[model samples]
Target chain A: MSDKKTITFPVEATHVMMFRRSIGDYAVPDTGLEKAAVPPTFPRAVAQFDPDYHLRLKPGEAWFGSGKKPSGVEGKPSSAGGLHAEQHFEFLRPMVPGDVLSVTEHVGKTWEKESKRAGKLVFTERVQEFRDQKGELVCISRGVSVRTERPVDQK
Target chain B: MRLKASQISVGDTFEDILVEDLKRTQLVMYSGTSGDYNPLHTDDIYCREAAGYPGVFAHGMLTMGMTGRVVTDRFGAENVKKYGVRFTNQVWPGDDLKGKAVVDAIRQENGETLIDMTITTTNQKGDVVLSGYATARAEK
Candidate 1:
């Protein structure tokens, strides 16, 4: 494939069963981050590996390619460390509070597509495996992401 | 009573789950968040006139996610060992969807209880939309 890249990101134990429940101790509503109806799961997903939040989007931020602006993945490997496509979370086991989790990711596939405005849309497929503290496979999330030329506003 | 595969006969039927009047907005919101921009879901005109569907349809993931909700709510998250399914039919918008899970078989090994469950989603007319199975651990 012309101009293709691949990448992977790991999900953490603490993040596997994490959710901003509409009701609960960890309840986090949509506060200027996302539409009120779209509860953000980023906190739970990213907290597993990146604690410091370095280079990771905060809650309510978009994953994959930002429709309006450049996602800022330049000169970096397609994996972009933790960049993901659509994460398919297969809940083999339910993770509860205080249950630790860990995830390992690998870029399984990569390809490229031609888009009218974005020129060449480079896509990467990432597969992430989640495990509990005991190292039991808990979930598998597959994601697809597209990369393209930076928009004028972003560049 | 503890829910186990042995307790549930293979022909035994589980409770029927129904979601009434799925809104078009629900499908739209799911599309926006899930990044599945398939015209079959959001484009009403395409769904009705072009695709021959009654209207826009719901994402299979939304229905699957709801099933996950049922499993988590029934057995609690910790008891779930693994959950997966393959979509077999399209769930159109505004159709009352019903879900039924049956006990396919039960097996225990080394103190671990594995209950094989078969899940089916059907339209209000009783037309099957999706069907699959789930494996869960029994609590000791």
Candidate 2:
């Protein structure tokens, strides 16, 4: 828990716009999108999380485990920093194209634990909030990331 | 059966999202719907011992679906702009889950209105089981 940080970044309407465009690609009966007569929108409320939004990172940022690859097991290590999870939103009140959407992020907590394969595991939680043109809370998001050490059995 | 968004005001709350009982049928259907097949939600014996439950519990999504029913009731499906939520806690079977949403904020532009909601789900014990925010287009 000692290595915790807090950071914030402003996300705009375009961020929301991108998520709406891509979420459908992930849609399948598995996530419950099968029976719809037409593909549903990501809902304007969740437009802020385009996932494609270039992750705003700070200097000296180090990632741990390899991340997910578009293809398979040979892809990037996902948890070098940690396994990332997110919650997204589309503002009921538009963030509008030019509005300064303040995104405040904080590395609230981090912890480590033993792992059967990787030997050790570290996890981090990041919280982000976006505010709209009126200085009102537009969206709140939490990201959880997990990283694991190399397998003890590895050569 | 339904309440128009205009009929509600800031601080006003709606009736509970009623379900007779958290039957296995609903949970099974929900697992199929949500793709969350955690054994704790389906296997009664495993839930009672490993998960420390009296019996199987309802999927958080089922409770969320109940909450969505509230949104569908208030704004109808067409006007709902977004519906996203986190599963804050759990709801077990036989729990009387009630959902209520209060208008927390509102904005208008070009005659279009969007309302923010502080939506909550609670058991009969009045303990909040799930909590999240929702936004919808206000009817003209």
* All-Cα superposition RMSD per candidate: 10.9, 12.4
lDDT of 1: 0.50
Poorest lDDT segment (10 consecutive residues) of candidate 1 chain B: B45-54
- What is the C-alpha lDDT profile of model 1 across A66-124, one tens digit per residue? 33332323343322322122334455555444444565556778887675643565777
List, for all models, the DockQ compared with the true complex.
0.09, 0.06
Candidate 1 chain A vs. true chain A: TM-score?
0.51
For all predictions in the order shown, the interface RMSD in Å is 10.9, 12.0
Model 2 per-residue lDDT tens digits across residues A1-155: 11232223333334323322222112223333223211112222222333322222224542211124221223334222232222334444433334455555667688888867556767677565667556687555554555556412211
TM-score, per-candidate, Cα-based: 0.52, 0.50
Tens-place lDDT digits, model 2, residues B1-140 = 44554776777666555565656766765554333444445666544433334566665546655665566556654465555565545577676777788788777756778777877778777887767777777675
Off by over 4 Å in 2: A1-155, B1-6, B49-53, B84-88
All models: lDDT?
Answer: 0.50, 0.50
Given candidate 2, what's the lDDT at residue A24?
17
- Chain A vs native chain A, TM-score per candidate: 0.51, 0.47
